[model samples]
Target: MIELTLIGIGTGNPDHITMQAARAMNAANLILIPRKGEAKSDLVDLRRDICAQVLAATVRIVEFDMPVRDAGGDYAQGVQAWHDAIAAVWREEIARHLPAGGKLALLVWGDPSLYDSTLRIAERLPGVKVSVVAGITSIQALTAAHAIPLNPLAGSVVITTGRRLRAHGWPPGADTVVVMLDGGCAFEALDPAGVSIWWGAYLGMEHQALESGPLARMAPLIAGRRARLRARHGWIMDVYLMRKEPSNG
Candidate 1:
């Protein structure tokens, strides 16, 4: 049986890795890191840096090209196909590295339970014993970086992706919304008059940038900043939170 450990390493910060994640990395016989191409080289670099800091010299590190989902295809279908392709790649790499089953680890960005698909891909490996080591999530970093609570006192928050927020509109009864995986500034689609936004890019990193204000005033600034950062870095990962005016309470 293959012992598959999915360790969340947080956004791009090495220190965000938990002790559990470090232990898992040190214990793994093989650790697979996916190359997201030159546009997102920082992601792979972060993975490599984590391995360098946490893994023992005896542990083998492998890099594999990640499959990109086709934007022209149905969104769900494209994602499913991409996941299958990734699973095949994982199986091939695992077989090549460890003909006999052994402990393996994959470093995940942010918590697997959030928006990441590492856990889903692991399920495709039948009989694989899956273990998860949670780390600081982007949501946590975004909220903490902004020095704001996730929700109003005695209230609740809804966590979602940029696509859902843009396509389905704000969820009914949601007073606070945390948006992630947004390649575009989906906040532009919302009615900004009464909304407040807290946005952060490269959270927890040295180059981190944060901006928050009334959505009407901050939307354009966040949009411009995001574009500029993406141009400078070749790619970017960001998240934001929106809340109704506190006076509405």
Candidate 2:
């Protein structure tokens, strides 16, 4: 039987790694890192840095080329094909490195339970036992960076992606929403009135950037800042939390 561990290391912060995650990393017979090309090379570097900081020098680390999804095709079909390619790569790598079947681990950027699809991909593997080691998510990092709670007193919060927010608008019955994977700053389309926005880029990293104010006021500022940061670093990961005034009955 093969044991597969998906360890979440959090948003590019070495210190974000929990003791349990560290143990999982060391316990694994092998670790795999995905190389995401030149633009996002820093992401692979961060994983390497985390391993170097915690893993014993004797631990094995391997790098593999990540599959790129074809963006020109239908979105849903493109994603399905991409996931299939990734699973094929994983199967090949595991067979080459752990032919006898032993424990293997992959360090994930954020907690697997969130919007991430690593857990889904792992399901493609046959007869493999999977375990997850939770780590900080960008939502937690953003809220902590801004010193705010995710939800109002006894209130609920909605979590959605930029695409969904653009297509569906504000979620029903949601007073607070945390938006992730927003490439085009979808908040600009929103009615900013009565909405306060707190935004952060590169959360928990050395070059983190944050902006907050009335959505109307900070929308453009954030868009511009986000562009500049992306130009400088060649990549950016950001998330924002917006809360509208609660209705008074």
Candidate 3:
């Protein structure tokens, strides 16, 4: 039986890796890392760094080129096709490296339970026993960096993707909203008045940047900063939390 473990490494910080994740890495017989093109080489580098820091014994590390999703096609269909292609690549690599079936691992950016699709991709492989080692999420990292809690006491928080946020307005009955996987600053579509925002980029890494204030005041600033950072680094991963301002009473 093939034991596949998906370990969350957190938001690009070596220290963000938990002890459980470290043990899982060291225990794995092989680890697979994905190369997301030259523009986002930092992602591969970060995974390499994590392996270097955690794997104490000899373990096979295989690097595979990731498939790009077709953006021109229907969104859902494009993503499904892309995932199928990636699964094919994974199967080939696993057969080549561990034909007899052994323990394998993949490092995920954040907790698998979140918006990440590593778990979904793993489902494509048959008869592979899977395990997950949770690590810090970008949300937790962002909230910590800003020194704020996720929600007010007894208040609710909604976690949604940028695509959903743009498609649907502020979720009905949502006390606070946390948006992720947004290439564009989707918050600009909403009325900034009565809303406060806390945003962070490259969160937890050395080049990390943060900005927070009334949404009206910070939306444009964040958009500009996000553009600049992406241009400079060739890629950017960011998250933001927004909530209606407390009643002045």
Candidate 4:
């Protein structure tokens, strides 16, 4: 059986990797690094850089081209199909490299458990004896970068995606809503009256951009900056936290 370990390597900065993640990376007999063909660059460079810094020189490293997801059709169906394609690739790589059945690892961006599909993909690999090593998440990175608390005193935090936020609007009973995977900056549609926002782009990276304060005041700035950053870098990953003013409630 293949002993599979999914190691979380934090967001972007290599230093965000934890000691546990480092040890997991070093212990793996084989590591898979996925390259996204459509992205501006290999977004998984975190895996390669971490391996260079943490993995033993003799440890085997293999790079594979990741399959692009079909953006057409139903969103759920498209994602499930994409996962199947990814699992097929993973099976092929592991079989070709570790036909003897040994410890294998794949470096995950941020914590695999948070808004990530690595765990779900691992589920498709039957009898692989999967294991996980947690690392810092983009939420943590965003909060840390903004130097702010993620929630109000004795309040609940709801983490969601841009699509959901756009479709459903503000969720009831949520003290703070942290939105991720928001390429369209869905906050634009929100009633910006008493809501406050803290937005950060490329968190934990050298060119990190941050904007905060009243949603009305910061919304346009965040949108402009996001466009500029994406134009400059060809790709961007960002997250934001929004909450209604306590006084307004």
lDDT of each: 0.90, 0.93, 0.93, 0.88
Ten-residue segment with the worst summed lDDT in candidate 1?
240-249
lDDT digits (tens) for residues 1-249 of candidate 1: 899999999988888988888888999999999998899998888888888887765899999999888888598998889999999999999899988999999888889999899999888999789999998899999989988999898877999999999999888888899999998889999988789999999998889999999999999989999999999999999999999865644
Q: What is the TM-score of each candidate against the true structure?
A: 0.97, 0.98, 0.98, 0.96
In the range 1-249, model 3's lDDT, one tens digit per residue, is: 899999999999999999999989988899999999999999999999989988898999999999999999699999999989998999999999999999999999978889988889989999999999998999999999999999988999999989999999899888899999999889999988899999999989999999999999999999999999999999999999999976777
Model 3 weakest 10-residue run by lDDT: 240-249
For model 1, which pairs clash? none
Q: Per-residue error at 41 for model 1, in Å?
A: 0.8
lDDT of 2 by residue, 65-180 (tens): 99998989698888888999999999999999999999999999889999898999999998999999999999999999999999999888999999999988999999899999
Candidate 2: 10-residue stretch with minimal lDDT = 52-61
The parts of candidate 2 lying over 4 Å away from their true place are none
True-structure lDDT of candidate 4 = 0.88
Pairs that collide, model 2: none
Q: In lDDT terms, how accurate is model 3?
A: 0.93
RMSD of every candidate to native, in Å, equals 1.2, 0.9, 1.0, 1.3
Candidate 4 per-residue lDDT, tens place, 138-205, comes to: 99998898889998999999999999999999998898999999989899999999899999988887
Residue 94, model 4, lDDT: 88
**Residue 37, model 1: Cα distance from true site in angstroms:** 0.7
Off by over 4 Å in 4: none
